[model samples]
Target chain A: MQINLALAQIATKLGDVQSNLEKHLDLIEQAKARKADLLVFPELSLTGYVLQDLVATVAHKPTEDDPVFKHLLKASHDLDLVVGFVDEDSRHRFYIASAYLSGGRTLHVHHKVYLPTYGLFDEGRFFAWGDSVRSFDTRFGRVGMLICEDFWHASPPYLLWLDGADIMLFSSASPGRGLNDKEKLESARWVERVTKAYASMFTSFVAHSNRVGYEDGLLFWGGAVAYDPNGELIAQGPYFEEALTVASLDLNQLRRTRARLPLLRDERTNLVQKELDRILSK
Target chain B: MKIDLSINTNLARTILTAFIKSEITRADYSRAVINLSGGLDSALSLALTVEALGAENVLALRLPYRTSSPDSLEHAQLLVDQFKVRSETIDITPMVDPLFERDPQMSKTRKGNLMARARMIVLYDQSEVFKGLAVGTSNKTEILLGYSTQWGDSASAINPIGDLYKTQVRQLSQALGVPQPIIDKAPSADLWEGQTDEGELGFTYAEVDQLLYLLVDERYSPQECVEAGFDAKFVDVVVKRVRRSQFKRMQPPIAKLSNRTVGYDFLYLRDWGT
Candidate 1:
């Protein structure tokens, strides 16, 4: 099966939810026009980053009764949409979250586990840590979703892979500054290599999306990218600017790559679990 | 000359002592040197340094160019006379003239920056000689506007005034008993003839400082600023300056290969013990 995916490089404003929502709607139309089966947006697509204490008031709980969720559901009815937002749970503490929507309803939602706190980031002050890793069965493949800092950790992706995800979709709103262009590109390359290496081992594909624009003295450098099961970069977008990058991945390639590499077949999970348990115990 | 609040000298002394103790602990710095501009910012910084590190340990360097007003030197001399701290005057004309001879196209702004950097180089050299740290004198307003030159006036081992707005700097200067002429005169880099900071920025320091106090320190949005009766253009200019000069606030980005690289993978300050 071949799946068409599009990643949007959205120009977001800090603390301006209405303008950001309008931009999101405009970009969704653009993605639909491009004939994309799946559209992925950046992290905090609704409310921008560096919102400080305002995030506590602005964070939305995505329920069936919520207007924001209903609007998103309506948009995603015709196309598979993946977007990021600040999510509030039963505890009232918010989490940086990503939602996958299909057929006018949320297919699955994943909460970002890692809340960056140091330097310019004070995510820990705004967001509560999430425990469970989320994955869902899609028409194209078993899909896993991770927000900005989630993929940075090895545990989340490894657990998702173990949970039988064949494709991983990562959304980010990575901040940029002077001389950060090279650093941003290198980070994308690192993510591609690591995710692709895992994909090659598990016979999977990965799609990455990031935002672009200046928000609170920080620039979001968007350079969305994709990797096939063979760990090759199939598509990549421009840096320090907004763009929509599309890539078509064939599921058959996963099987062929797995057959050639045989890394997954050769895995000794029993030994790996024992080692993991030992580390956890300590 | 007018005191907004009554001066409780005992309370003032206590506050000064606490500020000094906290700053020393925060930066883990012992000795400090102030670039004595004979301006309010530098005067307040000198007082802060003396209070924080003592008069004996806080050294003052007065770098006056040939074109600098005579009053600036006299004001600086007054500070030394009152404080009884170690002092030196280095004529920057000698150092700056040679650089300008090599690069004739150097603007007055560039020349002022060269003079500032030359002063810093001298200060750093003396810092090593005196085993002291270079203390910055720029207020938050100047820093937010990128008014100070990098590796020049912006260069410091540690800064205490980086968070205080210009209005607050004035208040602090008054509280510290900085000379009246230095406090009364218009703020300038003294880069060129007839140059004033407000003239260059196209807005009064008082207005800019108030706007910044609301925007950064108080967390007011552009909309909120307008709602609070600030001019829309003034708010726009302040926001634009903050956005355009973000590079000055951040560390130079480094490419990441290691699991923890500065700016990308690593997220903590170097002094922050994990």
Candidate 2:
């Protein structure tokens, strides 16, 4: 089976949910017109990033009664959607999360596990850390989702791979930073390298989308991209601009790539679990 | 222990241009006002503002005091002519000399600060009338060294070149086609006739920039910088300057008497709702 993926690299207004939702709906219509099977938006698509005090104001539950997700869920009845937002639990704790919606229902929600506190990020002070990393069944295949800093660490994607996720969706509102003689933003170069490495190592299709435009002084570089299971670049969007790039993924390539290089086949999870248990017990 | 400060000029130019455009547009303003000092930093900043918000949109004001170098005005004109930006030459001597005359025994530093603040007053006034943002021209080296006046030349709505070091600023000014003389000339506060930045600071920009790159960007300790082959005395001076000037780089702290003070817990981005 083949799946068409749309990378919605968009700029979000700071602390504005209504405007961002309207933009999402407009993009969903365009993605549907392009016949995309799944449209993935950058992290905090509904509520913009850098929400220091406004995180509580914009946080919403991914329920049918929620103002933002209701429209998104209705839109997803026609096409699968992965949208990032501030998720508030019943206890009123907010977490940076992404939800996968299909067939007018929410399939899964992944809270961003790593809240970067150092340097320009203040996520640790604003939101709760998530402790879950699991994959869920989609109409096409088992899919896993992770927000910006979650994919930077190897464990989240590794857990998803072990949970039989054939497709990994990553989204970020990553700022354009670190300029050197390499003629590319260091952040952009580093992200592409890591995503491609994940696709080849895990033998899973990877699609990553980043937002564009500026908030305060930070500029988000938009360069949505995808890699096949063979670690080949399948599609790329423009940098420093808003775009909705579509790529056709031939899921059969996963079988071919795994057959050629059987790293996943020769794994020893039991030995790894025993080693971790010993290290922790000590 | 050698540091490579070389950057991709093309990438820097593209990013800085986008920064000016996005920041100005975010504030719902389509124009920018720059006090072009006829120096390398302001020349480069004007070029970027022109590129970002067209030549006609940027208003370049050449604010000169009575003793300001004639070459400064000419150098500033070169950029105004090169970029075809709208310009106004305002003599700040009238506004600033009253204070200088009030205190005949005033120090050169005091005079320089007064002049800087005077220019800022005009720039901001024009910002309201022209409905543009005041773009800053301070570089990282000066900012880190506390070589700038607090709330004077350092004041700005948004700064595109604040992160670049002085060495990086020269590199970018060349790439952006700022006149060669401006980039090569000795930097000065021009408070006195022969006031060169290096002469006052007692070290060359190239020498301090390397140490600063290690200290600030690479997060090297003063001891580590000495280990990395920098002079201990020079490291002490730079580190102390950076430490002493900490108050200049940050907003004034608010007293935390309530649950959510403005700067402490009531955290919000500058572009909070816009």
What is the interface root-mean-square deviation of candidate 1? 19.2
TM-score of each: 0.54, 0.99
Best by TM-score: 2
List fnat per candidate, in order.
0.00, 0.88
Clashes (backbone N, CA, C under 3 Å), per candidate, total 0, 0
- What lDDT score is found at residue B207 in candidate 1? 79
Q: Which stretches of candidate 1 lie over 4 Å from their true place?
A: A177-189, B1-274
Clashes of 1: 0
Q: Tens digits of per-residue lDDT for model 2 on B127-233?
A: 99889999999999999999998888999999999999999999998999898999999998776788899999999999999999998888999999999998999
Can you write out model 1's per-residue Cα lDDT over A60-154, one digit (the tens) per residue?
76666776777778888778888788888877878888888888878888888888887667888767888899678887778998887887777
Q: Which residue pairs show collisions in model 2? A: none
lDDT of 1 by residue, B1-274 (tens): 1112222343333334444444454456678787888777888778878886789988899999989977778888889877778998889898889889998888887888888899889989888887778878888899998888878888877666665677767766777777777889998887677788999999998777777767875688998988888899889988998899888877787877888676764433322210
Tens-digit lDDT track for model 2 on A1-282?
A: 888999999989999999999999999999999999999999999989999989999998888998788999999999999999999898989999999999999999999999999898999999999999999999989999999899999999999999999999999999888887786899999999999999999989999999998888898999999999999999999998889999999999998998999979987889989999999999
At residue B230, candidate 1 shows an lDDT of 88
